[model samples]
Target: MDLNLRNAVITNVTGNTQDQLQDTIVDAIHSGEEKMLPGLGVLFEVIWQNADEQEKQEMLDTLENGLKKQ
Candidate 1:
């Protein structure tokens, strides 16, 4: 079976409000389920695609700082 996970995740959250989207992200992170990682990756991909270079740098900095803590 072919599963287009990125498309599925995008479709599932397409019309969500800011609050709804925030809640979904928070819930997914808090759940810590491996299945949710791909959905998060898709969301991050959307963000990365839309971000400018400075925004991308900020995100990378945040990720680096986060990883340093672990």
Candidate 2:
């Protein structure tokens, strides 16, 4: 079987509105299921690719802070 998880995840959310997207993300995180990680990762990859350097640094800083809390 051939699987393209990133494409699948992107396609699933392709036409979502901002509220819908937020709901999806919130629901996924609340579920605390390992299966949702790849979908979140694909979303993060899209954000990272589109983000400017300053935004990327902000994300990195937030991630670092989040890790510190764990």
Candidate 3:
């Protein structure tokens, strides 16, 4: 995993406006850079930390479904 991606993204995570946050996610996903995954993992960690139990379950279900589609 990219420790640099984690460091770069995590430090600037505070006070992100919605659009900026969306852009970060979108760019990371669409960048076609192999190193984007750790950034996504960081984002997922942020999401996971903030999610409630039901939401977490939903995320897990979604992930499971996506994996099954592979």
Error of 3 at 55 (Å): 0.6
With a 3 Å backbone cut-off (N, CA, C), the pairs that clash in candidate 2 are: none
Clashing pairs in 3: none
Scored by lDDT, model 1 comes in at 0.92
Global Cα lDDT for candidate 3? 0.87
Separately for all candidates shown, the number of backbone clashes (residues 3 or more apart, or on different chains) is 0, 0, 0
Each prediction's Cα lDDT score? 0.92, 0.93, 0.87
lDDT of 1 by residue, 1-70 (tens): 1258888999999999999999999999999999888898899999999999999999999999999999
What is the C-alpha lDDT profile of model 2 across 1-70, one tens digit per residue?
A: 1249888999999999999999999999999999998899888988999999999999999999999999
Model 1, 34: alpha-carbon shift in Å? Answer: 0.5
What would the per-residue lDDT of candidate 3 be over residues 24-66, giving only the tens digit for each residue?
Answer: 8899888989787777789899899999999999999999999
TM-scores for all predictions = 0.93, 0.93, 0.81
Better of 1 and 2 by TM-score: 2
Q: What is candidate 3's TM-score against the reference? A: 0.81
Candidate 3 wrongly placed segments (more than 4 Å) = 1-7
